[model samples]
Target chain A: MKRIDLDIRDGEFISLVGPSGCGKSTLLRIISGLEQQSGGSILLDGATVDRIRPRDRDLAMVFQSYALYPHLTVAENIAVPLVMRRLNTTERSLLGTLLPSAKAKRKEIAGEVGRVCDALSISMLKDRKPASLSGGQRQRVALARAMVRKPSAFLMDEPLSNLDAKMRVQARGEIAALHRQLGSTFIYVTHDQAEAMTMSDRIAVMMGGEILQVDTPDQIYQMPLDLRVAEFIGSPKINVLQAALTEGDVLSFTFADTANNRVQAAFRPEAARLAGIANAPLAGVIHHIENLGADLFVQVMTAGGNLVVVRCDPGGIRPAIGDKVGIVMDEARLHVFGTDNRRIEGSYRLEAPL
Target chain B: MTARSFVSSALRHTALLLIAAFALLPFAVMVSTSIKPADEIFSETLRWWPQKLAVIENYTEAFSAAPLMLYLMNGVVVTAAIFFLQVLVTLPAAYALAKLHFFGRRLAFGFVLFCLLIPYQAIAVPLFILLYYVGLLDSYSALVLPFTISVFGIFLMRQFFMGVPDDLVDAARMDGMSELSIVWRVMLPAAIPALTAFGVFSIVTHWNDYFWPLVAVSSDKYFTPPLGVMAFRNAEAGNDFGPLMAAATIIVAPLLCLFLLAQRRFIEGIAFTGIK
Candidate 1:
């Protein structure tokens, strides 16, 4: 494997988004020193941490399950990292010898813990045990525990995935706010495109074992560099139509000389719209319509025998299923993937999203 | 009572009462004679109850007749030392066997399990000779050290530890805890019920132990309780009944106190760890 040339930027939140088994978790563990990479170097703060133990890695991770200690109350669980750092071996074990000064450390840890807990709105639940906590509370305490450590960087792996939808919405903001407030580097991993879109300063889209593109979430959504990434990042999923570059950027579709005849063209749902056939660039039969509360995405079977999904207002009337409808896409939003399955990265521009 | 249904519940209770009576009979006799004058024990018929209470006198004379305090102190020291050292030695061994991925962990654990099959009686001679060679023959270490690294304790703790989630260990590691601290903070704290249960088993078994201690310590000054009980046979080569029953009663009290306090933990420990 060749070396990865990543910019070791400070105070940045880098999200690694990919399907499961993409080795994203393994990569995070390697960077955290919980696992060693087979053949790559990880530099943390410009120092190699691959050989160091996880305890010395100057990093903290909140797990997917929130990994709270079952034996400990939330307060004690949150204080574990602080206690591990501040106490000597004997002082840690003896109950009373350190209990006096432990008050002082407790006050300080509690203060920091309180701030994080309050930020996460888990302050009232601090005295309860983890077993008694709801999934969201445990997730918050897990975050507070990780945050109170004040590590040089934070490594989180799908921290919000365990919560209910409402709690996930609220927790994502708190975590993003915490990253801003602390100004520390964060390496987040999730399969959630929305989480990646909303939280990260930059998202690294990984596939198989390699990073396909590392860019802003806007760049990832609007201008994906690979066919797999474009198909992966949306809800109704970006529709891929069989298309080709016939004459000097004037592309058409044949569907079966498909041999290297430009296998797929991809576009976001919002990139295409219904147009009257007299003025439409493409024609298709309306096959499916998904009406989300605020928006509707209508899927159509194109003339070339591929589905194209278009996003529109729920207020507009939709074409009946199996009804032939004309579809028009902004030419610039059209993306062609060559037979090699890589995005054709030459010049094409669409009108920007209004 | 009628003959048919009369034997149903009533006979069931009668049979249970007889079993209870059978089990309690020896204990009743021991307590009865321990408080009775010695000559009455051999009387023509068994006395259902003692005619006189001489428990105080018997107890006082029992301790005064020998170094009972010294015997108890030795027993306490040996049991406490073995229990403490057993925990100290077995905890790390158990954690390493359960969680650490060493090159020969399977082979090592199998070998540790192999130690279980070797009987103490078969190895007693070599152990005694080794203690004698090291000049630890009359010392408490001779009695305590051989039993400290308990194969059973390691095996029990390892079985309990295998249930702990690997993610929890990884979380501890990510929280900046050293592996040793993780055992103490995370593993051992969560393992208390099972440890207490094993502790009771170890204490009760070692407290009643006399064979190894008798073989290792020839000096009466280092006598443990059961060995102290054996002193009765020695003192009664002339068939002196007065002191024999008293010493036997003396040997039984500590075990009673230990069990009464730890009985709940003792029985439940095996089920708690879900291991043998």
Candidate 2:
């Protein structure tokens, strides 16, 4: 009985991000009319698409596997959409027995193929079959195919998830550029936070078959609407330390019955600072350090049996393994989630990004 | 090569050759004995080669004994009818059985398998009586109707259709194609090998099927080639074995040619049909 209440304006580049099995893929399929949602209807540009066949829906989806028809060559695969679009029922009737339409459908298709291939920089791979193309090349062909249709919207589901890390980064920029170039509504789905962060103008973070938050990427990262969104939208997996918001707005944390546990202290690793204070605000043994030359993510196990990751500079000094490090995560950057697993009321007071 | 290895290789080849000769002996004897003059057949000694090739003479006489050209036309028409009819019916049924889900679907498919078990002979008399009542007896309808729905064709197509990725079909669906269009354009094109294999099977089965033609067709003009081949052994050729073997050779040659033409397709199709 759930509903997808989408009011995304045309030409918006929206990324649907979530963990696997969160139904982001199902949502994409339903929108494209490939599948039916048992209850609610899907509308395309103010028109109901519930009864429309997927081809007539004017929606093109680039599947996660690229779903390039393995039996078809690259040109033929890309040409499928155009063929379905232009060829009338008569012209396609059993070997074109019905008089062939003398229209310029072929010329139009050729022009479309040329334009899209150039945009995707894949003109050289026009006739090659999908098996001959590398992964990156296949991705571009998928993009070109989707773009060639000139559909009202493009539906892409985790298109970059199949590429290697470096290629994914390059492909990310290209997809974002393509979205802008077309100026069409793009509903994309991905499970990677980095992908969501780098490419999307706005992201709809879905979890457990529901959208937890839908907002611009900066708003999602800085002012998450849900506790799950806060944890899901960031890298180094945001640390969730159990604590309480006590009187006078002071947040304190502890782990035992004899100790007082209060407001939940959630913060990104880079927000925390390290100092040599004797009675440290937060202290732990330096357990695992991932040094990326510029910045280090030092994973530390606190005395309370909670793991707090702190990002520190590796400039001219390296903290020895197992050595105790005193750190204070900036209070202003901390986000608090309530017992209900919702963001604590009035906890996020940061400026909302435009 | 080592002595043992060489001996084993030779033994394997010798075994294969023997098996080949064993299988081919009747055919060789039939062709050889067919052209021996009527007087020399059943003589004290057997000859492996004909004194003269009398194939055209034998064929012309075989035609004269029966309207063989009419029978040949009938065989082509019936086999063609069966083959094309099978392709049409079984493809969509196979697509439905392999892909779609509806109420009582499993039961319906089980019934198709059950239909496979009901032998043609069990229903042939009943079918004839039905055809007689319906004014279809002695007509092509008798031969075509009862065999229109082929369980073997359906089974082969369904198995081959199973290996095609669900996503590919789903993609076609998403592309706005109806279920039937998907079957014709996507599924069938992808199943060319299977269709060819089943085409061969269907043609051979119907071509060699003399019993049904014998019962369904009382008209000599409607007799298929295999049924007409039966005319050679009438008492006129008693101990005149030459003509009978020539007819047998003709009967078997078409099957050999068909097998050679579709051998690779048959092997690959059957092997890959079970992929799903």
Candidate 3:
């Protein structure tokens, strides 16, 4: 990763969000000590842990594949870390079952496993193998296995990517609740921005092996530092119109070789509204409409030959396809970007006669 | 079923039975020869059943005339030793070759494949000379030592281990298991079918092995079953076919019982190896 640096706070639920092959999963693996970073060292709680093995790192990981031992029952799989750490070789053997100390340890491990299973609501499925369980249930078992140890942190690599859409929404809430209850450090990696936006305390937007921006979900959506971050974090992506900035902070936009007109610029779809055709400054033909129950998004082919999506209220008059309509740019909500795609400050009033 | 299907089924069964009879014809001859009286054996007429049964005399003489029992015991000891030692050596080697990345890993695997191409018979003379120089000749060491490092066993196990997912090993490592523990506790259990297949191959090869034991051993105490059966063909027992057949039956019985018991698993294991 090219000079990527990140600081994960204690007891914080930080998400690493990016597209595929953006080094988000690789970063998580490096943190878990599963893969070593060639150039940098990782410090856990002020200790350099780069030399430590994964087993000794005192961190638990939930894999995308669930990675449960197929031969073992759910309870046994959950008890594996405890068995490895608390019991010696002889104590884990068949003969050791007869020893009093080993018996006590085994009983303690069993109780811990039961408690973790109860937490995940998978108590009744303790005797079943992973293959027999459904995908969601197997995911719970993987979570139980990771939770039974109560390690320093939990590193999850797209743990819910294998679940169905409905299950993913439910699992998102459950994981957020889990983080709240455990209050442990969680470094979750995912390619889904919605998952990161909804579940993380802070989302780190990664791209091209670098973290573009790190902020809360609201801040990331509202004030993206990079153009890529702004486009990636929202659905029906933020529209960009090619414009040239003239003197006196006046924005000049031209549509299809038409004469340039001065206007206040806005990027977000929600900031544009339909206005009366007589006095409205911008006009576009309605190309398509998407009705998502409460909100209707209208896609318009602007006179500039650019497609722009405008979020319209469901209760308002819906524009028909191929209808020529005027657009009123919300002056206060407009985000002006310079030629470099960086947000430009000192916005002026809308120059259209409304 | 329908009439036509029934007729086809009958034809299939008839074909299978014909093959079974052809396979069992030699065993029938061995049994009939062991039981027939000496005069009946010389008679021109072919007798399917023995006119007189010499079952008791033949079996008793088969055991008493030569140390047939001793030879059978030696065969058991040598084969068992070879199998156990081969597994003990091959499992780790295969696991390393399949999973671990180290210096010379590709070169080492290449050497294993190269060794597989060179038949053991081609190296037998050099092996025998080495054992002779080490003074291990005529002992069980000479019988068991040469077969210990089975290239086929290593190759089979490596192929089997390759099928095991890397996630399992990573999980085991994250569970605080050492490399050795992963080999035995994780990979070994998962490779049981392949191990069973290799076990059958190794045992059958070593148990019926006449040439190796013939070259390595000369003493009566260390003679394996096939060598003992050959001993029954001495000049003194010139036409004594009864005891020879009895000894042959005893020598072949254990392997046949083993194959019958584990035939399905053996076939599955061999089939898995062939696909890889």
Best by lDDT: 3
**TM-score sort, best first:** 2, 3, 1
Ranking by DockQ: 1, 3, 2
- Provide backbone clash counts, one per model: 2, 8, 0
Give the winner by TM-score: 1 or 2. Answer: 2
Cα lDDT tens digits for candidate 1, A1-354: 234456647999999889999878888887888886788688887878768888888889989988899989898898888878876665567673457776676678778777777877877888898988898889888888888888988999899888889999888888899889999999999999889999999998888878888999889888888999988787879888666565435555543474334546777888888977656667888889888889888888877777788998888875789888877787778787877678886654322222
Residue-level lDDT for B114 in candidate 3: 93
True contacts kept of 1: 0.87
**TM-scores for every predicted model:** 0.84, 0.89, 0.89
Higher DockQ: candidate 1 or 3? 1
User: Runs in model 3 with CA error above 4 Å?
Assistant: A248-266, A275-283, A303-305, A326-354, B1-57, B270-276
lDDT per residue for candidate 3 within A1-354, as digits (tens), equals 888878889999999999999999999888888788998889999999999999999899888888888878899999988998999999988898898999999999999999999999999999998889999999999999999999989999899999999999999999999999999999999999999999999999999899999999998888777777888888878876665455565455542355343233556888888877666656789999999988899998888898888899999887899999877776666667654556666665544443
* Residue-level lDDT tens digits of model 1 in B155-201: 89998889878778899998777878788888888778778888887
Clashing pairs in 1: A332-A349, A332-A350
For residues B111-224, write the lDDT of model 2, one tens digit per residue. Answer: 888887898989999988998899887867777778889987888898888887777777777665678888887888788889888888888888899888888988766778
